[model samples]
Target: MKLVLEILTGVLFVVEVGEGCTVAGLKDAIAAQEELPRDRIIFVLEGDPGRTIRRGEDGVPIVELGFRHGSHVYLFLEPEEDNGDDP
Candidate 1:
């Protein structure tokens, strides 16, 4: 399926994955396409209110979660931790 990832910054990315792709795999695709950290990626599934897909649900396949071709999802990238280097 072809999914559209809209990051918090308004940057958009299109990821192509197999039908068997799981949430974890989807995150991996997003990270690879945008050079982001998979661990920090969260998903707000379209039409699923109050449900934020996270790492714990990685085992679940996206197809089973009501996703289809051209499915749009909001990608929330967890803010990076501020190290001591910050002034």
Candidate 2:
């Protein structure tokens, strides 16, 4: 399955993998493909900040979560404003 992950005001990356690709794995995949640093990447799932979402009470890694086939995950580049314009 190919996961379509898009970041607001940034880039949209696609990941092709077998079944059972976790969110955390997806994150690593994106970083690898985009040549981005893991420390500065964040994913937003279901409209909530990925950092705030819990995998098992603790904050979850973007790679460890489950994604539906053809599902799209939204990622936000850290250190960049959600809105491009300065406040």
Candidate 3:
């Protein structure tokens, strides 16, 4: 299945998987695509936890990231810390 992902204040991408894809897989795909750090990214849906949607099993409804839809899905993006905090 092909999945589209969107980030609120960042970028969006699509994941085309043959068998199935989960939330974690989606995150991995995004990270792989942007070459960004995983810890800096956040995913959510409809103001709720995005991980819940991600953890859902096969056949479960998923938010297409890069689509123009209603308030069904929401993806937020925030850049992670680029360097260690000053002591």
Best by lDDT: 1
Pairing residues by index, what is the TM-score of model 2?
0.57
Sort by TM-score, top down from the best: 1, 2, 3
lDDT string, candidate 2, 1-87, tens digits: 777877786577787866655555655677788787655666555533333332342244334554556767776666743675766
TM-scores for every candidate against the unseen true structure: 0.83, 0.57, 0.45
lDDT of 3 by residue, 1-87 (tens): 554556665565665644345455655666788675554555555442334243233233334442223333445556545687777
- Cα lDDT listed for each candidate: 0.85, 0.60, 0.49
**How far does residue 36 in candidate 2 sit from its true spot (Å)?**
1.5
Can you give the lDDT of residue 34 in candidate 2? 79
Model 2 clash pairs are 23-62, 23-63, 23-65, 24-62, 24-63, 24-64, 25-63
Cα RMSD, model 1: 2.2
lDDT tens string, model 1, 1-87?
899878878888789999999999998888888898999998987774645787688999998887789988889978788888978
The 10-residue segment of model 1 with minimum total lDDT is 46-55
Model 3 lDDT, full chain set: 0.49
Question: Which is the better candidate, 2 or 3, if ranked by TM-score?
Answer: 2
Comparing 1 and 2 on lDDT, the stronger one: 1
What local lDDT does model 3 show for residue 43? 50
